[model samples]
Target: MREHRGVPPILTVVAILVLGLTLSATAPAAVAAPTGKPGDVVRSTEITDRPEARMASAARVFDVTYLSADPRGRLVEVKGSVSLPKKAPGPGGWRILAWNHSTMGLGDSCTITDSLGKDKRGSRDKWLGQWLRDDYVIAATEYQGIGGPGVHAYLDGPVAGKNTLDMVRAARTVVKKYVGTDTSNAFVSFGGSQGGHASMWSNSLAKSYAPELKNAATIAHSVPTGLSDYFAAIRPGFPNVVVPDYVTYFSYVLAGLKVSRPDIDVDSYLTPLGRTVIKNAQRLCYAESGPATKGLTVGQLVSRPLADGPLLPALRQYTRLPTSGYGAPILLQQGYLDVVAFTPLTGQFVSRLRSNGVNVTYRTYPTQLHGLSTAQTLEAVKWANTRTTWPR
Candidate 1:
């Protein structure tokens, strides 16, 4: 946790950090509330100067409250973290590495930034630390509702995309103003699992939503694509017992969908016991919720199959990746043995992207599992670096 030479002391900056400010009277009614265009910082707090164990090369860490929109255009306050490297920015400024995190939980405490002060190291830290050493500013989103007001929008791609894109903008603003670390608008997006889904969405939506982040590269590892097929593979009707231990993930998805899509009633898809399980899920994070649903078969969880229900169309619409309009280079990595995202589905997804005229690089590992795919960090980092540094 060594401090850099020119950075301000942790305590001094934290003490004087700005709090909430009132909205201006002359602001337009559309954005007259606490909201503004995406990435506008409502407030910023210098959380710490001492690098956390997971962030070994961080010179300064700040918790930022910024503006982002939901799918329907409602303004919401989103919280995320920005970590600057110890080395000073170059003449053009430090480039950004936006890290969208995997599913932790639907609860507020599941925020990845909350892990900053702990002594333990996260699995991604080894590679994330590598990026820090290479002098990249890391900006991570806690997603929509993890540390903010609304319910966590688990797999909703557009919402997560907007949040991820805005995080980079907020990180640049906060670091330049407070830590004196100049940051370039150039950036790369990377994530796995739910994060992987967000990464693809961010790249797909960048042209229309945030054109400022042009030429950004994306790395999606162990991405869960082909949502309709995924649901069918895990349903109880499958030949053998499938995903007995992972039913909890579906529970969270159901709960999250209920939050985002008000017209769909979650109770309609669940049995009496399923209702109780989902109720309990709303209170706990992933660790607790996963174990809570262990040994509970999919049949017991739902009265009727999701495939037969009216919810299928909506589920397909939200969960599937956009077929085209990706404006940047994409690199997809999948593990052969991954049951969660499934290897064949990822292959199919790559095919679709290629068919749509996207420039995609696909890689598969033989012995890697869902989580082990994260070990590809070094290669992924190098790929992103090359793209971001490429001439516009």
Candidate 2:
């Protein structure tokens, strides 16, 4: 009697079938497995088929997303570019040049790859072209967070060092796929400004972090070794008038430290206007942010003097140069006339390195500005090439 009141068997069957189909369509998809170990290529796309006329020797260029790690060893995705030589690899394979770029900004838009050949400064293009012409495979890291997720870690030495080393590991994958499997395990690290900091850190980290990498040598130019010294040097004159560019640089350092050290409250030390400008600067590239802070003095930017704030201690911790643990020879290049990374401070850092038993070849360029150290590109390439071949 109860069944008689219910729907007929045929209709009941149809309803059951419809419900099953809907469930199947709405079911959650299975999660994908982790790709592989660090240095594994997550994916790569050929962004450019031919190089710029200036890079005639470069066969192809690729934009790559690869697996790396943050300072805490959490898995992170890093984006970078690789340029292969037009000529085929020799029996010994191609040697790698890991180019750690200087400070562009703390934003994703500041990724060096975005303006590889089109940089208004043209310095990068010229430098890279020269490397390619010399038949060295160039692998340039945009650095963690520059074109990837999270905040650009600015001057965090370990993070920068790891990114530099991981780029070389990822470059090996590219070489095996496109160039040849005969690629040399030997590589060199070099950079200037923030990049110089990274280059030094990479060499220091190589033995501990990536023992497999044959880091032949390291070259750092116009290096910013200590932020505390830099801050003291750049403090406003007696009149208290500061270059607006200094304000922009300060903003980058603050923003970077905020991300890397989330436990510290960066906003507590800033004035309301300082907080506003920093927030705006976070979204801008280096070019835009520099001008935005122009004409603003130190007193106008912050409520309390930077030296009196909690930032100094943190800066001191983050700004120290690695005194030991680097295995390769180092070439430190400084500019006598460079006010940005003042010559005197750099000289002191070199002295400390030497005292620590570091084999440092210090070269000072007279009558040159901060950017002039990069003009040693050709000489550095030769230095690295010779070291890789001679191994002394």
Candidate 3:
């Protein structure tokens, strides 16, 4: 109902991007860590902290470390959490409800799991608990960075999708190998803000990437689509304050590309200030990243227009959400007043999906709806429940 642009607007719009997210580079292999399959449990330990336990409610909670791959298919360790039901599953067995978080930051210090114990994360805990009460296994990925290695590929839906699906894979293994329980292969990807963007790619890639798992539905709320368009929206010497602080997302997108798409030579497109800002962005959390980039417009961030460089093509290929190829039902929750994701762009995305024969259910909210909307959450849950592939 309110708008907050001081933070995450890209994955969170990067608008109050709001989620404690991070994607990183290779986890220091020098540091001793467990080893296993991509989805196998590298580590799984239950949370015993009083506050964190309260979040678990009746569900069993486990902090887990697992492996995922980058766009280049390089092995990367990703951190996530899994919550299991205390009671038995329904006749169809336990289904997976994977949570792809919004952007928090892109550094080791900004890890979401580590911050989960804080008092501020209560709502997220509640959200996870709701899924637990629904009798679903909850898998929340901290993306590819933080507890493991690699940068949290900000706004890179393909990488986000890979991390999300792999987290589901890791969750399945954590529940089975550690708790001695097996979950069904069915799942639904749910996310808001940056996570919303991630959910779309996670579900879209399910058929091709995680073919073993069946995605019944995908819920993307306040998702940033048509990323290429967004990249092009900003021009140099543009009036200040014309855009909200979310303009910092340009630094994030470029910071991510600096590592993920090194071929683009991200530095080549940026001025000295741009490179320095991006370098700082790579290590700073979302909150800090914004302030660090204060007063800088998108135009100031780059030496030339994005269209003048190879960045646009890379952004289109790596970041943009596709409208077609959704095998499962898709739900899009948009806020009319959300300048971050822009309702008009989302409308176009919805139209493309429907035109492509995707089962699309698009809803509108009056505000940005960055944080959880009880009405929205319950409705999305209900919609997802009706669409899950329980029989499969």
Say which candidate scores most in TM-score: 1
Model 1 TM-score (2 dp): 0.86
Q: Over the full model, what C-alpha lDDT does candidate 2 score relative to the true structure?
A: 0.76
How well is each residue in 1-392 modelled by candidate 2, as lDDT tens digits?
Answer: 01245688899899899998997899787656446777888888776653432244467788888877774667678889888877777777777888888778878777775346654566665666677776677888988887887777678888888888888999889878865565678788888889999999999989888887888889889888667755543332313533337777777887777777776677766777778787776667889986787767555656655576567778777766788777889988887888778888888888888898998888887887776534577677777666555222
TM-score leaderboard ranking: 1, 3, 2
Model 2 TM-score (2 dp): 0.85
Tens digit of per-residue lDDT, candidate 1, span 10-58: 7556644532122244434553457478899999887765445236667
- Backbone clash tally (model 3): 26
Of 1 and 2, the candidate ranking higher by TM-score: 1
Worst 10 residues of 1 by lDDT: 18-27
Candidates 1 and 3 compared: the better one by lDDT is 1
Off by over 4 Å in 2: 1-35, 50-54, 119-125, 232-244, 373-375, 390-392
Q: Give the number of the best model, judged by lDDT.
A: 1
